[model samples]
Target: MCIPPEAQWKRATIPDRRSVPFFGQGRGLTDSQSLDSIPPPPSPKLRRAQKVAEQKAQRIQDFKQRCGPGFSSSSAWQARPWQHRIAIEQGIRKQDALPEEMEVVEDPTIEEPVGINPVQVEVGEFEEPTVDVEEIVAENPCQNYHCKHGKVCELDENNTPMCVCQDPSSCPASTAVFEKVCGTDNKTYDTSCHFFATKCTLEGTKKGHKLHLDYIGPCKFIPECLDTELSEFPLRMRDWLKNVLVTLYERDEDNNLLTEKQKLRVKKIHENEKRLEAGDHTVELLTRDFEKNYNMYIFPVHWQFGQLDQHPVDGYLSHTELAPLRAPLIPMEHCTTRFFETCDLDNDKYIALEEWGNCFGIKEKDIDKDLVI
Candidate 1:
């Protein structure tokens, strides 16, 4: 039969101990665990716990010194004996050796967390659209000149102050010609023209371009043609073209004192002026020489070199004094080739009239058949 439930539990429990001494108690089973030999339970004071906490703190610091971003520089790991002693005594991390990579434990004095949550944004304030005001156009006050009742005074081309009239006949003081031409003779003209009395009629086409000549003669049209000749036409145009080219290609003396073309032209002019001054020949023969060879072909060449060197338009250099120059342009042996090259007649050594025609836009066939190279 099963023992009663309480009686079985009582068997598992030691019988009431009336006879054993206080230490010799529980189990004759273990001598070491006898009641008198049983050791006291650990004290509530936690001396081991304190030691364990200190070890754990030491381990944490060692871990930081070895693995933190600034690990090598940490005082705990620093090779300096004094630093090591300080680390051991203080048990506090050095601020200078604090790991850059570590998320520092927040300290109110040294490492406070910033409040950086995004601010709540409120939306839906509507702004009124601004309207731009336009400038006002004032009315033209049309004042009446004839009857003193006009609505607005009219403005003239020059925007001068003037009265407007409804009737032309009533205002004699307000004399105005809608279309007018004024005439004044220039006192600077060498001689007065009796034909157009007050003003000399400038001999020009309706389009205002002056006429040119085929040849100079004791022609009545010479004065009207601005004293230009068929012979001088090419000379004048060449000089003008040379001047323009010189003007455009001109550089300051600092950049380039004189260009090759300019040097050639200056030399040629200098040579010609020297020839003219010797006066070994009659003026008539020289005049004839100028006229004969002028328009033929060499006129352009001679004219190219035969003008005064005016000051450069950009004003880099002051006007140079032009004296009667006496330089032999190019040695005689190379002069012929140099002349052709200077003219760019062939853009090569050969001097061909066809090439000259091509360069100057003149007809090749029109070049004088008798002209010599």
Candidate 2:
């Protein structure tokens, strides 16, 4: 039979206890237990303290890594990237000192000892007592173009004025494209088939080869003279002038045969004329309808004055040849030449007019003595 509940409770009521191992406590133990022996369940304060300690330790490790093996001395610890760099740099400067390379220059004012041989004294002498006209002048020691000592006025290959070779390695004309050849050929066929056609034309017959090679270099401009600036007008201005000026010369039916490039020529003359009127001193031009032999300040730009019936001169031909000099002229569409012929006449050189007057219709008489073409 079980004892009654009240008697059982009374028997077990004696007050005795042993220690709790995790809490490190015997009966009524003090709170200063070894932390390693009995760790408390982590609290917010304990966790925060642990994190702070970890970060501090990490920072110390990083500092040690930066300092390397030589950082054993406490006084040499550098806490910043820049400060550490400076310390290393100082060490390097000390290690790499170049005392043997030192050059000692004497003060010119100091006089040599009286007993010293005159030859040795003269050999070392640099300062002259006074600049005498009779005394031989020292020859210039600078090399050509390498020394900034040359007079700055010098002409480049293109005759453009430039700085002399003070900085020999840096030439102002170095980046300039002294020569450039810009050109495009008519496709005639679609892009893909054109290549095959070009090949067939080139290889099948010498005549075809001569034809295809003609379209090279920039389209020649018709100006009365040697001014490259006026000959190559800005494209937009040329286009605007072409639209308006060619209208002055071409009839719709006649213009149908002229190339787009020919149309641009007519446009440039017109545009430049307006610029000239605006005091730009552009060259005045006369387009003669070689067919009618009608000389006028401006051509009937709409009417196509095509190629001459006979070669004006038997030599190399070019796009400029498409221009007519006499009446009953055929347009370029009608008067054709071989391809290679276009590249002839000093192929690399351009057709330069002797003077501006020969390029435009205006002769020396028409020009005022004070005016420039």
Candidate 3:
């Protein structure tokens, strides 16, 4: 994800593809708290402990719902209570939690002294454990440093962490050919690590500047794009894009995958009686629908460009910026490479917003910036 130290910041801004979607970013709270059960006996300490555990569990569940999907609030209280961390970890954000309270459910037979107040016991009886921050760092200084892909963090003589290119041989070997990748130099490498490490070695040279990952698989012959095929490429692509969005809208009952503007745009396509549903349709049908519903495809075309143009939010797209979309699409859509190459009409090594729209058959006058949102 980076070329060198100078380029590390750029790739750091790109979100990791592995993250689950976060919904209601600004919403402060979720209404996930459930009605609590009362303790069998009337000791206030037991009652308060039950109350504390219920509140903690409710907050944990709310966090799950905020992060979204596969996390629900109906589970029983945890077997153990939250442990108090005397010193917060370097990069971890702190969350609200009671310190080292034993689970009331796990130790049901025990009882707190009837006359003692739990609040005073928690505050006055307990003291924060003294920990040396330096000892933690001394154990593993490299753990806190952020290293880009193809690089590893290492401790120097002074024990300061720094990024260095990783050895390709250290990368795990796989027997499958699918693990292989081809670089822009047309040389096939064993894996992504091998490819990127090779690139990292080339650092600040002209060849390094020129070299990039070509595609996901081993290099092979890609047929040249004929005039007719290039023209028809957008027909299937636009229809496919529109149907994808519509499908997301229909299934997005709880996903919140589409934004407000995107939902509004896709609603038109979802409700249109003439709109094409996703399936393997003949080329003639694809072309016919493109002609009939030309307006529907325009926003999808521009929206895709905006999605990929996010590293620096510039009007142009570099090869690195296009990798998220391009790498996955290339194997299925062979024309993908030639289509994009031809899109850069001025041969500036970057595709501007106008060139992208033109490639998808949007008229120059109809390519509105408002549609990109």
Task: Sort every candidate by TM-score, greatest first.
Answer: 3, 1, 2
lDDT of 1 at 325: 15
lDDT, model 1, position 336: 22
Q: Which candidate, 1 or 3, has the higher lDDT?
A: 3
Question: What tens-digit string does per-residue lDDT give for candidate 2 at 81-140?
Answer: 344333334433433442434568885896665586554366446776775588687643
lDDT for each residue of candidate 3 in 1-373, tens digit (9 for 90 to 100)? 2122212311332233111111122222122432243333344433543554455555555566565656443332221111111111210222222143455776456556546655324445767888767644336777778886678998888978889988888888857988888787989899988888878878889998888887888888766767787777888888878877788889998757888888988888788899887888888999888889888888888888888887778888988888877776677777888888998999999999899998888899989877777
Error of 2 at 178 (Å): 37
Model 3: residues >4 Å from true position, as ranges?
1-148, 153-162
User: Model 1, 7: alpha-carbon shift in Å?
Assistant: 33
Clashing pairs in 3: none
Model 1, span 1-373: residue lDDT tens: 3222222322322242211112221222131221223343242222332343344445545555566644332232233444323322332222223343456778675443335735533345546678998889865543333222221255678754464333322323312321111112112211112212222123333421221111111111113222222233333333444344344344444536454554554444444432233224443554564454343334343333333323322211111111111011112111222222333433443334444444443555555423221
Full-model lDDT for every candidate? 0.33, 0.33, 0.69
> In model 2, what lDDT does residue 43 have?
41
Q: Per model, how many backbone clashes are there?
A: 11, 25, 0
